[model samples]
Target: MTHKIAILGASGYTGAELVRLIATHPSMEIVALAANSKAGMAYEDVFPHLRHLALPDLVKIEEIDFDNVDLVFCGLPHATSQSVIKALPKSVKVVDLSADFRLRDPEEYVKWYGGQHDALECQAEAVYGLTEFYRDDIKNARLVAGTGCNAATGQYALRPLIEAGVIDLDQIILDLKCAVSGAGRSLKENLLHAELSEGYHPYAIGGTHRHLGEFDQEFSAIAGRPVKVQFTPHLVPANRGILATVYVQGDAQAIYDTLQKTYADETFIQVLPFGKVPSTRHVRGSNFCHIGVSGDRIEGRAIVTAALDNLTKGSSGQALQNANLMLGEEENAGLMLAPCFP
Candidate 1:
């Protein structure tokens, strides 16, 4: 059964990525493309690389006919997706690529996002879209919230260890570097080419990054206690990908074994050979995540690094993967394309 899909914010990078990946999906078709600012323009006009595919012109979200759309990919901004998704037809399964429904608590939503969750009913029903760990939940969920790219990377390195009880709960530290594309296509004074190209610096230091809410929620749940890790995110010069280096107090071999065994049957997660670290270039533009582990100079400590495309596995591709499960289609059907190489 072919599923009809509508991308609610088609002019942005993640939305354009959804179009690019869905263009090859055997069971999905892009029936509607909505971008309020770019409404009425062909998708090709917004993303010239998509010029070859036959696609619909952008429309306003309010104008879409959900009766024909099986799935909706809401790639709007964090605060914007909540209301937009709440208005979508109930029968249409939604994979939101924003932060609207990621945190489970409404109070935490206001604390981190600075406003009350406008769609509390949907918030209660939305499933966190961390594909590997939440596969069963996502498979049956009608509303799935895609993770923050930085959150996804940090979790890849720490989740398995936390779940296995092989790492010290209080000592986890995540030092992550993300490409500019993760910031979205918005223009900002700090994101200017001149300001960003020549140097790299950390922002959201000292556990202030919004994604920490995700890390705290997920890790605390896994450990059956409050597990807060020291997390710092840095903006890098490149355009697409996130690399997280996680420091954990544990035996290196045990950490490696835990991750390898945990993801042994997963398709999109790759556990590299022990001591061999992964690079962002290896997983660029693909849904795959590569994890590598190595022993630290200090005994009882290990460093695990995870790499993935912020736009793909970190956002749109992950949205589609969850959509497939929600629709009962093959999980990796349209996501098997290999990563691009230099």
Candidate 2:
């Protein structure tokens, strides 16, 4: 039986990505599309690149018949998802692509996002959608919370080292360069061409960024201690992709071998040869993560760089992977497209 699907917030970047991937899926059908702002338009009118597909017209969230939608992809903005998901029918499984459900603690949610979490019950039940590490949990979960794209990229580079105790937990640092699309298809003065193009700068420095909550929560859990890593994200002019450079005190070869072995059987993650590195261009527009390891001149230090399309592996693609598990579909169904490289 084909699984019927509904995409909430269908006018945004990640929302359109769901249409792009599901268009080619064999067992999934797009029965509805919802976008509050573009409620009366057709899908093609919102995203011309997706004009080829015969999809449903966009409508308000309330207009969607949840009884018929076997699964839902909530791509709405951050705080919006919590209230929206709370109102969803108990029978409709969901994969949420916002920060609403990623962090498990209500206090942490308040600390980072500010204000109390109105949907406290749902927050505790949502599974962290890291896919490989949380595979078993996701398969049985009712609501899977898609991770922060930056958090996903950084974890791909460092999770193995942290788990294997091969790196100094106290002295790790991550520097990420992300494209503008990760900011979403929103209207912001900073996103204007005159301001963003031909320029690059960093924001959320000094531990103020919210993804640090995920980093701290996940890493600290893995090490059974307070593991803190200095992280800074820089926004670049391109449209998609994230490049995360992590520095740690460990053997370069050990780091490479650990990552290579950890992801050896995983289809979407590729670990480059020792002393080699990857470019964001290598994985753009695809659900693949390329990680490379190199030794620094300082004997005890190593640099690990990981790159992937922020829209794909980081957000929408990640949501679909988790949704597949929730609905008992093939884990990699419709997600194996090759990376777009020039």
Candidate 3:
């Protein structure tokens, strides 16, 4: 069964990524491309790397006939997606790659995103699309919310440990480094070649980062109490991937064993050999997340590191995984491509 797909925000990084992955998918058809600013331009013209594939010309959101689209991948920015998805026909299943529907509590959305959710009804029905942890819910959801790239990376490193009760919840810390592409295809003075190429620095320090809302909501639910981790994100000069180094008070071997045993049967998650670490370069351009654990020289501490392409496993690929479930297709369909290596 072929599913007709529409990609909103088609000019952005994650949108192009969705196109790249779906280009090779046998059962997914790209029926529409929507990018308000780039509307009426050929999709290949916006992303020349996709020139070899046949795709529709980009159009404004209003131009799309949702009735023909079996699935819509909403890659629009945070505040914009809520109103857009709420207006779409309810019959079209949606996979939203935005923060708008990720937090279940609309009040939490306001606290973190600084606005009341315009689509409260839609948000209520939206399933958190973490894929590994929320698979069953996604399978039955009409709208699935893709997790933040940093949030996804941090969770891959820490969720298993939290669930197993092997780690001290009070002392958790997550330090993350992400590629510039995760910032999106937008132009920022700081993202310029001269400004970013040679140096790397941290932003969203001191718990001000918005992804903390996701960490707070997800972790708190997992522990049945408020679990807040100190999180700091750094923007490194790269095109893809995120590496989260999580510090927790736990037995290193136990942390490694829990992760290994939990993800051993999972298709896209790989728990690296104990004491070895994973690198972002290894998982670039793929939907795979590689996690590793090492003992701290200081007693009662362990370092858990996870790496994945922030654009793929963290966003577009994750949306695809959820869409597969929504459409009754194989969960890994169109997402089994291996990582790109130099």
Q: Per-residue CA lDDT of candidate 2, range 124-228, in tens?
A: 899999998999999999899999999999999988999999999999999999999999888999999999999899999999999999999999999998999
Q: Which consecutive 10 residues in model 1 have the weakest lDDT in total?
A: 204-213
lDDT of 2 at 341: 67
lDDT of each: 0.93, 0.93, 0.93
Where does candidate 1 clash, by residue pair?
A: none
- Per-residue lDDT of candidate 3, residues 140-217 (tens digit): 999999999999999988887888999999999899999999898888999999999998999988999899999999
Model 3 scores a C-alpha lDDT of: 0.93
Model 1 misplaced regions, further than 4 Å: none
Error of 2 at 142 (Å): 0.6
| Per-model TM values vs. the true structure | 0.99, 0.99, 0.99
